[model samples]
Target: MYKLFVAGALAAGALAAQLTQVSNYNNSAKAKPGMQDITFRRPWWVYVPDAVKSDALVVAIHSCQSSAQKYFQNSKIPWKQGSDRKGYVSVWPSSTTECWDVSSRASLSHDGGGDSNAIANMIKYAVGQYKIDPKKVYVTGGSSGGMMSNVMAATYPELISAVSLYSGVPAGCFVSASGASAAWNNSCSGGQSTATAQKWGDVVRNMYPGYNGTRPKMQFWHGSVDSTLSPNNYQEEVKQWTNVFEVSQTPTESKKDTPEKNYRTDDYGPNVEAIWAVGVGHSVPSHLDASEAWFGL
Candidate 1:
């Protein structure tokens, strides 16, 4: 059975939202049963609050090997009946495979075109089905899903207003030779010869285009202790997009009661900002906290 959560604010006419699962496999013939053909499977969980008036939606993407269900569970946002209400909708789309389709060095190809198109379709579906405010639509994800969120911001800037990335590298992070001139050239080659790796890194960076001015707001969060993906990539992401947005770095200090120490750096621009969550591990912080402080929710 599916899970449902509605807050008292929704009942009080402050907000109205609900959670449901959407099956995208039937939408395309490319989706085959079993393993006969490499078909694309698109399944997502949606959260809508009663307070939502129109055109305000948030798309939450999941990390590698993570499902939309788990993302919803990990999220501190209230998803059950009668909880704190925010008049908005959240949609989480699952990747057909364990990860996103950022494996290609050319054109950002995935298992099928559906991976990219499915998101657009989902947006269209939500806008039509609900009275949504298109200007306020935002996207956020972690790890592989975070990479996908960057791809979304780069490719479909018009549809999204802002993006929040948790422990996510740039889109070309997985590409063969994508970080030559930067400090990560040696590591980009995976311990291969620095000279050879640098060549590949340069090629990767050149081939892929950085975010132009016509992009949405952006936010990045990474754990300083995270060894999975080097923290340098996070810095590169900030540098590459410096021209498009006005950046700001704010160091977070420890509170009297909290033992864990963290620093937050925010890059502000016309409609975008990137927040680097330092000293933490590879995980998205509490949405209630991030929403109130960083996201301005």
Candidate 2:
């Protein structure tokens, strides 16, 4: 009878472990179990599916004026529902400031003890806690979060597999700013962040010096009429990633009115792609589906 009881208890414990639900966690730079020291004490949330069929983990970052729970629960992308069906874990992280620190040198440098490093450490925590495959980790977001996605791609190339950015700028576009002003760059957002392909690629390579390895694939999206962040930033992002991939600036494949009306796609190569959503505003939730597909989630 005792043996049967023990067996039943073990079964119940396993079942509880597999339950699907959203969990909240608080972590600081002072206590890191499996990674580098995180300088910020940011809170994060995770959505675990009932059955995690794959090893993929998607880090969904919120834009400016947004929180982790707000993005996770209120996104138009049906994040929870999609995770349930797609069998991939979703992590949402809140920014310490109003926006991600993309323009700051600390955030731009590799492990330079900024919000970016804090985020990287958080991802490492998620990987170990959930037994996630490091090679399958991905990041996606809108506006400031989108820009931070590029920051992560540049600074922590080894941690991400692919990224889908919405209304973002190129890495190091706002490097001219410092302090709190780094949170928002008027010049970069005003469409003055232009550079040659080689120059932009050099900015990314400088983030992690002497590191030659496979960089993560990238997908960039922007609303053609987005005034909040000038549409020109999209073109700059294309220049940046194409140069990193050593591909031509001209796309090999161009599709018009694809996936939706007035939405165009350009494929520079397998490693780089861009989408221009016509007549849209700063942020478009409709492209979230395509972003997930890009991550193979």
Candidate 3:
């Protein structure tokens, strides 16, 4: 079973070069005698130049109800290849289950929020097992996975240097949409009128309480046409981050000569950036070119 799972995951990676999987038993002797072992998938591509060691690592989280294979296969294409003929390692781990435990739903709230811990452990392992630069670690995700990325950044600020999210809500954010139950507090409660905006405000405030003082470099992207998660939420996220980082907002428009279409960037702080894609759906845009342009791999 484990071998099959690994083989399937690797096959998916071959298509996008953004995924890998490993199986390991829970060796904590203090636990039960025979708990089910874990088989997790993660991004394994390292964008490096030649044989030189990487100066940074990117840990990507996938969307809810989505597997690592699907997310990796759908991301910007250039990321699958490395930068300047070099590559930096990118990691993506499957959630404990098919859906992340972002809400209080009985079916989602299992694994004791080990998703973030699992990521931290993976980084630790990578540092010891591979040549990785500790100061340059970054995280990103989309949709539900995007929410998890936010949670990880908030919960483990010391472990991450920067974060980027797509069509996602903030950490610990829950909403009572048409078909969803309202279990966890909505991250958008104390913000703008739109659900997306409110959630963004709440997430930034809750996660970066000392934002007025100091915060990490951050970036966010959302499609204006995305109704599943709402593009307005990205605006609120940018507003909160800019306020926290004490940066001026200057909207700059640019056109990508690709399927991603036109987009704009808001420069918040010296290093903070937020983008709104004009016509994209809930999916990650192939135009942003994360693998090649953003991370330079």
**Candidate achieving the largest lDDT:** 2
Off by over 4 Å in 3: 1-20, 24-53, 75-78, 83-85, 104-113, 175-214, 248-261, 286-297
Candidate closest to the true structure, highest TM-score: 2
Q: What is the TM-score of each candidate against the true structure?
A: 0.67, 0.86, 0.66
* Predicted candidate 3 versus true structure: per-residue lDDT over 1-297, tens digit per residue: 999999999887666532446444232322112322232223333333344456677776776676666656663623334432455676656664665545432112222224444566666666555577777677777777676666666555666777776666545555333323223333342323343334444555554354443334676777778767766567666655555455544544333532234776655545466666777778655333542344443
lDDT of each: 0.55, 0.81, 0.54
Output the better candidate (2/3) by TM-score: 2
Better of 1 and 3 by lDDT: 1
Model 1: per-residue Cα lDDT over 49-159, one tens digit each: 545543467787877777887767764433222122555677888876777655443224321243544675676677656666777777777777776777666555667
Q: Give the range of the ten consecutive residues with the poorest summed lDDT in model 3.
A: 104-113
Cα-lDDT of candidate 3: 0.54
Task: Write the residue-wise lDDT of candidate 2 on 79-173 in tens digits.
Answer: 66767878888888887678877876667778666777877877888888889999999998888889889999999999999999888889888
Output the TM-score of candidate 3.
0.66
